[model samples]
Target chain A: MIKDIMLISELGELALIEKIRGYFSIGDSGVLIAIGDDAAVFSADKKNIVTTSDLMSEGVHFDYTYTTFYQVGFRLVISNVSDIYAMGAVPSYLFLNMALTGKRSEEEFDDFLKGVREACEHYNAKVLGGDLSLSIKGDFYSATLIGFADRVKTRSGAKPGHNIFITGNTGDSAAGLAYLKYVKKRIPMEKNMEYTSREIDGTILDTVRRHLIPCACNPETFIDKIKAMIDISDGLLLDLYRICAESRAGALIYRDNIPVSDGVRAIASMLEMDYMDFVLSGGEDYELIITSDSDHLDDCILIGKIIKDGFFFVDSDGIREKFVPKGYTHF
Target chain B: MIKDIMLISELGELALIEKIRGYFSIGDSGVLIAIGDDAAVFSADKKNIVTTSDLMSEGVHFDYTYTTFYQVGFRLVISNVSDIYAMGAVPSYLFLNMALTGKRSEEEFDDFLKGVREACEHYNAKVLGGDLSLSIKGDFYSATLIGFADRVKTRSGAKPGHNIFITGNTGDSAAGLAYLKYVKKRIPMEKNMEYTSREIDGTILDTVRRHLIPCACNPETFIDKIKAMIDISDGLLLDLYRICAESRAGALIYRDNIPVSDGVRAIASMLEMDYMDFVLSGGEDYELIITSDSDHLDDCILIGKIIKDGFFFVDSDGIREKFVPKGYTHF
Candidate 1:
């Protein structure tokens, strides 16, 4: 049986906004005005505000054939919230901007909104308000996140002799992409089943879920112990290089100490690719990389140490190799 | 002679960011961390922070054929800053998001950035940081503006007997658009010359400039007396209807009191159209429509009065006509 789909145009702009407003409950104590206003108002609560925005465009940041609208919306919030967490701040508000091509079904858009609502609830954040417009080519989703922190961490405070640590595992998102490429052609089609519910290999499924719902690190618990921090969006090597360049320092990473999941390794082997490449240079991991004193290695993997000058990678053979930075570029 | 045009791919991402960074000076005492970080951090100064974001997509919100890149960027800042001012806040910082199709010339992008910088300076706002990505079709510019205010004006506070007021003139933008459409077929193209510098009739030129650089109304001077407020993006009657719907009140607008410019009147006559239609339904004026007590009418044009139930327009002949809400919609 085919499912019924509705177009946003049929609902009109005001009705569409009303529908979106219905998805979010905004009784939060700080939100003064949420939807249906010129601008949303909220209290700052006497803390420094950290603001960030990111844009994801069709055919540039995503391909809808392999992903769903829900994942698109969910990942946008996660990606933006990750930046706030990187600064040891708690995300409090979101302003979403969506440009649609007018070809989307109402169900798809609803699923996208549901994903956004769920993500906001997960992070204790509220959707203040945003603008929606029509696009000529494809969909564009831009998210602006506002966060608060008493003391914020920046990328310019890492000093020499600080230990480098990363929360959770890396390379799983890249492995998920590789696994999807390998098995996409072999999977049987089921029109009614959602992508997440489709039957797949268990090992590959885990990695795929990791790609779809990449976790964000909350460094607020140990913010005082951390010196500098950044999110791993453009791969580990490139982000580490950014920390080094910003702080006027360098890093020495231990290759064996880097965290790589078993599912990622298995998928990399199945795809005939080097797992270390994914671990070192894969983007969109959304994990936090922190530079801290040795006394504060509580809930993270200690993978390296800050150096005085040049970036290096210590191999299993006990030889240090100079590392060159290369990763994703929007251009 | 034809001028040289450089594509974004030739400059790469990092160099493009560096070039963009050079356009603005960031010695503002409020900015703790500007660009080159995961997110931008600024001091909120113990005041309520007002945040708003709007997206302008090519072929939807604007067209390159009739408008210049500089105008596009300038209008974007104006439109966003208007929202801040509508909330009776002072715009302080900007986070810009651009999605390029990799086909834009260097000079064109520079012109757009120049417009943004000038607008920022004009409003005493600083560009903190933003994200850039590739687009499949045309360019998309999404801006998030942060402002500060001691008190805020929302659309839910207008009560019956409150006087309706507006800042500056309306309908000029729509008239300018009509004039552009009228003269575009007659003008001869000059290579390498910007559209704003092109020859045009003086009467229409002022209206066109009004459309391009729409001014925002700063209401902080009398925010304490304002009951409800909204920016006039989607016509006079429609936005008034929004204020009415949100505040649960109706409005009685005097048709003769609606501010229409001389250039708009002339163009309306030449085009055989009603100038009031443009005044009632034109979008992109970026002016403020405010409702306040009679005691706080300072530096504004009084146009109407809030009523208890239904919207009506009183003609010069003293006939009350039911006002139906109609304006721009994305769909």
Candidate 2:
């Protein structure tokens, strides 16, 4: 077979960055302080700034077997934003750094930038300057987010009696991942790419969609009341365990009270697997797991409470047991 | 031969991050605003802030055949610091993100961090936090620098009558790189990793040292007098071209006035190569290129003058001609 594909190696690095810079009009986004300078210069009026960065590499953090550059780029932004939002900061500026294999096509690059722009627009965050470089192997995408907040929240602020709340259903993305691996193809959720996700069936559509291009939830509505906060990237139990460890407390959660999606149940049933496995330990949910003292909090689901020192879980039959955290771990 | 090296894959991502976090005592730094939170939080009182990030990848940006993790790590910090310094910003806090392969040894990892710490301390910058993930192929390192300044200088502020100044000798690092590529092995620059550079010979030691690990010049001493500035990451002519295009001006350079290091001249003569090639177009010198209206400035070499419209180069014999830009570009 004859493959006449144009590689980025032929285009050169500055050209690639120029293509990326073209995606976002920097003047309007407020990143043009020193446009042609070595470093980006700007002024901030806020009292406090929250910054977070995450790197997603090819074949390790993501796989092209069932995902596209667009999905990966969008997910990268959300992951960083999830961190800022978890710190009770409003994400304002985003900087993207990409290291791609020399053989990647320009089409792939454009699609990735498009995904980044869409997600940034959805969050009202401006795209600032970043870097584009070459990698010897698979692609690596990183996003460093800067947000401003008057008061910041850390994970070590949870008290023993604080209620453990989750922003949304857990394991849908993991469940979605399961189906995508089986199919091993890009399953289109919508014909056109839009910021809003389309409603779909649990059996195939939503699960696959969630796994491939999961959306990161924003926790702004109740960010002020949360004493401790973390985004559930490394599974619910594992991340909750982190909060407890940092806060010097423990957590007790009821399995029945855990919010789950129909997509997860459908995938577990079809794959002859335990749905609880995905609910407890599957990664990349990107939901906010918070601790708060308020009982009448809005936009959150109560599943457990902070304990003095032990990690415990309760089944639907009211049987309680100790559990260890097992989630995705990269080297 | 059986190798019993401990790999980062075995240590896992979180443990590797913990290992890195242990390197820098973070409580004293301004970055601990929300320690153990999703994002880092801190307060900045300066009116203007400058930020810059760069990614260096294996086989692309650096090669293990001629460099060590220590040199690579140290070089990474200097590279980003150079950008921030070029903007006339005092680099304050730095965040490092690394993606390593499963086969990389813990020793290499530690050496890299040591280099990072040594460079950070040299610049009086604090190590905050960054992500450590797994890459399927070679290692990738990235650093994001946050610096504060009351006033900022950019490359766009130069005009037709400004005198171009360079912080130090150009083409030294590029000459060093050629030697390292020829040698194809790690050369010791210093026995103990101190912040200061040890004196060495032009033929072998200094050039090789410059290539393996180079120091980025801080333009603070002459910063206030300069109207425009940029760091020479690319060749002298290419970067000067950038300043010209951005400032809507041009440059006229003298062949004898452009500072050429003894190391560069020695290597070029020994190799029977054109020394002007390295002086004109060599990349990674990391010296600051600034333009000032002042007649005389301390601690800087006057290399050229901003011309009215075209890039003109004056030879040592008083012959003048237009020139083209050529520098390093990665895909």
Candidate 3:
């Protein structure tokens, strides 16, 4: 018979770890040292090595009330793998560090680990090892994934006159967040209206999906010939600025040519916020903002041309102007 | 004049990453791609690589109230490097993921970073890159260190009859903790006094030092010659079990030969606790426990000998006997 009880201070950290160790079994090969050490040792080869990390805090990065503990676990895995994909690499293994809240329910922990196991199967990355600890007062989570990359591409390779392109429409997450705020405000609105609370349901769901399960570019099949690339994390405009800065070139993006989804534009209009601000400053829509030479424009869509000066913008009036170099800031 | 306060929720994840892009000023030589991408790209010549990681949570691992933030930062860096040292590798670089309370006083943040910077310099490991996130509530910290190994050693590499040894005495941390607890209980204590709480003062301070800055052996200098190795993290007896289990060997530890500091002993005596329990099961000592057939007892005091069987024990009665396997556990 099993007894259900609470009171972690009685067991302490060492006993707690021992209790949890039974659940994890080591995989054969590649892992030299798995657990019970200061760190996990892995057998790595030169042909492929990938590493990325993400931090998810409680109130800042997640809310236990709104987001189920399971969704948080799934997104944590994807965030790391998404980095591997951005490197034009395949996902392989992961190492997680979980800082748990004292009041966390056992069911919540079970669901959280289940979410991790599911993501591992989805991406084929092995959950090699991790460290688990209890927080003092509040809860937090972080993860680092090590992947495999053969030939890698970087953001510093963008050149002047190179065509800049992106994978999908921008402003999804930004608009969805605005919609959430509007709904929370209890503002009266029509049912089934496009930008209203109900009509925006599907778009918000899709945005949430995109925000959570970050879609990675198929790096294995396409990374070899790529010149300069970046994940569209910061808005397209800001990401372009980074690519240009590192590559020692400037870019002039045509405002009309930028991809802004219908739902995104409608939300921006409803909120009386500039569509361009969502397109320029809004973040978390993980897409690829890539650049290739002018000759390769047919190979990729031409959003703008990289110039020698710095970040530039071309409006619908055909007037070219300079733009500030600001992206997302946590501090 | 810093009028705009950036809430992580307002910017989301991508824009937050973009906001920090300007801070990455130095060009990484091995980097094929840095920030603003899915994963940072790194290139290297075909060679065996050593990688390790560790996580430090707020309450479980440390107390910010008594422990200076700088010491906590320094200790985190020290802990990861010690693992690399245990493998006989020269640490090359590090990647840090620090989750801040975000509402930290500037003084606190600066002190913490200073600790990190100083530790990096001490270990000769460059801080190549890092991620800073606003945590939910507690301060969360984790680090991954990459090192180059000339001759990597595994715990399973031990052969039958190899001598087992450790670098230094153990259980200092437990002694320190006991002392800290006694002091916290408002027990009046004097340094060098025979009282359990009294003997704890000096012993606790010394043990606390051992807990923070462990003696790290330059593993690269000796790992090639060593047959099997593991850090004495969980305890000497437990770690010996791991080496024997992996190497398909057995070990007989000479309990009388095990090293114990006077301070550790004093604390144990005062607490009316078994000295062997503190030495046998105490975790986080971070000293290297090695096994080699070459008979290098002078280099490190020999504590045991490998046998052909599965497991054996040297008891308080000075008789050797068979027993169940033991070690520290991490969930």
Candidate 4:
């Protein structure tokens, strides 16, 4: 008997995305700004503008299976806003694109809008306008955010001797993911814990909160002295390396001084994983990592710069040199 | 027995996009712009800024599917330019975001850049900065276009006493789709025909071409007397009603006077569908449907008219009646 083979839908969105990527040819100027950063960049002067977009698939990016309507809405806005903040720009407006499936209750739509509205207000941005469509499958969401700045900080701006400073702690989202996965493993006892999640030590509960509601700094706050800037999305090591590559530089650091939350540490210990690796390589941190002039060391101290580029870790008078370059890579 | 559920990647790009649209809340903003329209519109000041976004999913929006890398690059730029034209705005600049699947070849990336460069030159617009990302699933493409204008031509601007005008003939893209589908069916046997396609007497072929590559007029050219405007995306009749709703107006279109290509008439007739209906409800027509100050009828002659409220259409006998609102709906 002869049989015919069929392509199954089980290939996964990631795999399908891989197949699609093959067609694109990146021109020298093809990207002015390419993909895989906090936001896409092009060249627009007058007032330098930064733009970013993200698409959240119903089942892939989110799971109504585990995510609440409100959580979904919050994450959607946070993800995009984080990009603008990453670029060291104040997010001003967002355009949303959505597709719906089956019959959605008016309440669900209302909650969704409320989520968007609240995020806008919180970040001092506005929901300018967007496009909407209906789908035969599950719901999908895409958002484009526009932010303005006089200068933009790219991943490739760190100098060889510049100190790297992050606005907040990292690896909370990864820890949160672990917690969520653990909770899912013990089902039949579902509790809406995201909104007012309890304090957990060494497990990044707070860092996760920071991830959920990352802060946005007005670029105007420190207009000068910010030699280079980038958002810490793809882990500090990776994103910083990008800055290094773009700027053609290298870095040095003290692992002892790297910030880590109690919850993240606890979680890492429980999972038997290296906590430093999480802090070093975890993506979605969403903090601003900046390099400034040495004369502007005041700015670094004001913004919390802990590690210097030519630093040696001293343990009981035994000084040893070390270099850290841990960042996220999609491939 | 356990039944496994479906995943998004298994669904492909089109299915994923449908899912994204499903999650958006369009609110009461009249027209629903979805999968087909070159751009989407919402209620805003006719004299203010018009906003639209075109998101290119790395794998879905652009595939290695029967398209050139440069074509993909050019089309991405062209797609947004068309949207600004659709809204009757002089497109000025663009904000782009892209997500890559992997390390792009330097030469290929350069070619992609050339495509964008050529497009920018053709459109007379500047490339604004945007975000870049590495897609966990695939490469992602997105752009937000900002345009300035005096009056935004909406689909809801037509009134009863107004005459309907179409900028050009319809059904080119529809015809294109048919030819492609037919050719695909005859492949392996009549493969030679693929390289050379002739114009058909009456096929949706013309309509399909119109769909694929639309001609646009500079909205700024007629800014003064143009009271309302909407790019013909979802057929004439449906788009007309949207104009009517917005302007609190109606329209009187001469059914026989409506434009239809010979190719469209031929194929539509074989399908036993009314050519007028195809002209009326068949969409992807990028012509401008506008209403104007009847005093400027000479200028407005380029397309349709401005009528009094209520009497949207009139017959040769001078009898007027209501026309059912039937354009395109995503939901």
Candidate 5:
């Protein structure tokens, strides 16, 4: 069985579904009915139900040339979980829809499902049900996550003088992406994965891991103090722009206060790309961007402030300029 | 305006998402937050939440040879809503995920969204949050529907003596599909849509409408009386087998009692196919099959009875044979 190649074509839809049911047997008491049923049923409490759905398609979202099936599945959950977490909710149930293409072995499918199950269990959530289909070309995965929140912190509620805050460092994911595209393969970060001579705490391996199997920040500790919250999924400037638009306000970013990993800076420098491009405009950080009236939030860094009407950024040289969102935009 | 062709490529992802958000504006008071956010937020009540997800992929699940974009969108919603209703719940919130490929006009995309909105509003559901992605291959759609149920009726409650009931006629959808495939295009079935000289009340047009744009039977009237329920997305015998397997019981389907429209019979004969093939082995009927003790149920057709141990079907000649499941299975 060392070279086991269990192709999906050799199995029936029912068998595949049954195997999925086996992997994600429900253990939550709140779930009344789970997989193998027409619909998954759960006991809903009187709270704000936060629901988000996300899609990641092969060749469009993730490249199979360098990614593992498990990474795609795990990353999909993290992406959706990030949204629910930003809404100040505890993610509870997940429903997945997958359309697979090409010749994938049963072990490969199991790896994908294992990735999904592992991520769900890590977040203390349950995989209630999922639908499977065959694709004509390239694989596509979609996940719907439902969570419960007592108080939902939307992108609104920011006012003038409110400090714009963000968690963790940016540019790691984008820099890792660049490295992957450069090397054309996954690399180990420990042994000179950094291209630059300058030493940094975070290396290219960390960046690559952040890009591939990133963990979403849980805002449980500081969610209550925030007036507005959004995940830095579409880069710092773009997500800040979303907050500004929603709250009918503007933002002023302190360039020196903005954090970028030295590893990303080195990678960007080596690749002949602007490090600011990955720092300000890089997406998929999965870090929480919060706004508060006071700059005294825990574990969150003060990066900027809400303005009266326009977006601008002050550089380390004390120069100010108009700031715009330039993250990857899919058409 | 007459020669307008709004391509998705011309519109950015943000613009396309904004259009979708505009089309499905939040009208439900229960929804605290709708589209245009990181996620959709709804006030959860103290009830059971029934959730279901389904995927329909192009080139695998559907063919564009004769189908309309409007029909595909409309059908996806119906398919998800049917699962919710089968659990005795009122469909409430919907999440859609779509990946579009090839050249699509703005009008065509609008038609697709219009179909989704129309079907959603028909069942009083709101399209919350959806993710849009570009696909490298054919178009694919996935839907996740959430509904609240005061009391959900699953398929695990049927008893040995419960009368098996169903709503609507079988073979119509399958028969219409056969006609669609035979004609090699969409057909106007008013004049001799009936394949044989045998006259039937239902025309191919009716069957085609049922097949293309189906209206799932709502089990509201008899749901309370039923001990167990399941929607017939798969064929009759297969769904019956599912119920039996779930309830740990057996079924006796009265073959004479299995209703088949004369239109389907005529068409089956004309196409050199067995009428029973479409009637018993057809999929996508969207009919509700229930088990209840009372035979005096309203608007429900009695098609079979639950037996103690073995699955069998009695024919018009009073001969019984073992019943096996044979339907369109995707693997």
Candidate 6:
């Protein structure tokens, strides 16, 4: 006798949700009611509630050729949680909406849920409630993160003359993408199709991990020192431009001061591509670009200063040039 | 000179978002910071924050054949707002995520936004923040609603001997769908491809309006009187079964007491279909089903009684039969 493989279509909506809910435990004291309720109920103990939502669709935002099911689930949590952190909030609850195409097995769904559960545990957040549907096209995932903050941060709070700082190194994710493309082109092995972490070298794996699971800065420790901040999602230059446009200011960036990791530089050189392009234009970095009056702060490197008029960048030779904004756009 | 028609693809993500944002105003005092930020900040004055999210895809959940763009936008808001209402909450903020296919005109986008704005205005809710992306499929819309509730309601609170009641009329939306399909089949004109309100008769139009623009009950006004509440999105019998399963109880529904509208009966007779099937099995009604000790409620009609052990239905001849649960499932 053979045991049948269960598909999501066979489990139906409510039963599949029950299977997904089995992975999550409502241990948070703030959560009054969870999964089966019409809407999840939680205590809002803070002064303000900060909410953020993001949507990721297969073929549009991600391709299975370079990503795994677990990575997809983990990355979705990171994207929404990073937004909460950028607002000077500690993420508390998450609501997920998934549209599955029924091509995946039950084991794949379980692995995805496991990734989501692990990420929520890492951030001290709980899965509250969500909706699931069948998709005719492909898989789509949406996450809504709700958190609390005592001091809320907005993009319009930066002033002229404030120093611009960025947390962690930039352009690592872009270099990872380029390296993955290069590896796929160079290696003619069938195992490269899966792109598992063990199949690659340590240095390359480190860059790929950074690309897949980027860390978010906790704003509770630095909320007072920062004036305005935005997550480096659409690359450093475009995000900086957003902050300036919102705050009614401009910026002057030092090209040499932009932080780029050694691994990124090595990969860019191997690919015969300029490393500066990745630092300035490549996106999905998930680091925070902060502006403040003080420059020296823990885990932050100063790269520029907010200006009152024009956007410019000073090269290594001390020659200032107009900075052209370039980054990823959905359309 | 010919004026070029603006497509969503031409404006890109940020520019299209700017156009959508122009239709809304941040008038709510709870909205501290809206749109243009990484996340939206709102003041949660109540004891608990209620949150619900729903997703609607173009071909899966709806089609342009029978519904307009404005109706799609309006129904999405209604779906989420109804969930919050079922939790005895007043919806205050909404975050939308839309994946546009780049096939829609600027005027169509504006009309959709207009529908969202009008619905928000009607419910005293504000559009806070959202994400927009290019869709490889048709189109997808996701709504995340955050609201405040003094006392939260859940499905597990129903007790045995409690009287079950439902607000508004049942089977209207399902009947409307049947009537729309009938009209399309009867009319041979090309204009029948798009079902507008003016193309149908007044009786049929009333049912179609109920299907398109649903009204959610404000549970805040009567939260103290209700024991358990769930929105009727998956038909009457299926929703009742969910409540029973969650509460660890059973229900005894009276077949003759289930609310059915005159328009529904008329349309059912015209289509030569059983009206009882529409009332019990058809979904998307968006009505609130409440269980309480007292049957005398303001806008609700008593239809059933919670039982201790098994689910059954009593016919008009006073014969009790086993009730088999049936409704919509998105598998």
Candidate with top TM-score is: 2
Q: Write the per-residue lDDT of candidate 4 for residues B127-201, one digit (tens) a residue.
A: 554544443344445567766545455555454555455566755544444444454432111111233235443
Please write out the lDDT profile of model 5 over residues A215-240, one tens digit for every residue. Answer: 88998987778888888887888788
Question: Per-residue lDDT tens digits of candidate 2, residues A1-331?
Answer: 9755544334433343344233223334332222111112233564656778789988887788778877887788888887777777778766667777766654566567767777777776765546667677778888777777766777778899999999888888888888777767765442245433344343557656666666667677776788988888888998888788778898899878898788798889988999999998888888888899998468788999998999899787888899987676663
What share of the reference contacts survives in each candidate?
A: 0.44, 0.35, 0.28, 0.09, 0.43, 0.31
Task: For residues B150-218, write the lDDT of model 1, one tens digit per residue.
Answer: 666777679999999998788888888887777763221222234454456667767777776667778
Q: What do the candidate models score in CA lDDT, each in turn? A: 0.74, 0.73, 0.63, 0.56, 0.73, 0.73
Q: List model 6 lDDT by residue over A18-136, tens digit each.
A: 43244234343344434331123344654566778889988777666776666777778888888888877788767777777746555456556656666777787666656767677
Ranking by DockQ: 1, 5, 2, 4, 6, 3
The top-ranked prediction according to lDDT is 1
Against the true structure, what is model 1's DockQ?
0.19
Q: TM per model?
A: 0.83, 0.84, 0.74, 0.74, 0.83, 0.82
Interface RMSD of 3: 15.8
Clashing pairs in 1: A6-A106
Tens digit of lDDT per residue, candidate 3, span B91-129?
756667777654565556656666776777777775544
- The candidate scoring highest on DockQ is 1
If chain B of candidate 6 is superposed on the true chain B, what is its TM-score?
Answer: 0.81
What does candidate 3's lDDT look like per residue over A1-331, in tens digits? 8655443333433343343233223434344333332123343554645567677887766555545666677767776766667666677656666766545655566557666666766787655444555566666677777666565566678777677776677777666656655655322221122333454455455554454444554545445556777666556776777677667788888767778776677677878888777777777676677776534432344567777876677888989887886655554
Put down candidate 5 lDDT per residue, B130-174, tens digits, no spaces: 676667777889999888777777777889999998897888888
Task: List the lowest-lDDT window of 10 residues for candidate 3 chain B.
Answer: B33-42
In model 3, what is the error at residue A136, expressed in angstroms?
A: 3.1
RMSD of each: 13.7, 12.9, 13.8, 7.9, 13.7, 13.8
- Lowest lDDT 10-residue stretch of candidate 1 chain B: B185-194
Interface RMSD over true interface Cα atoms for each candidate: 17.6, 17.3, 15.8, 9.9, 17.8, 18.1
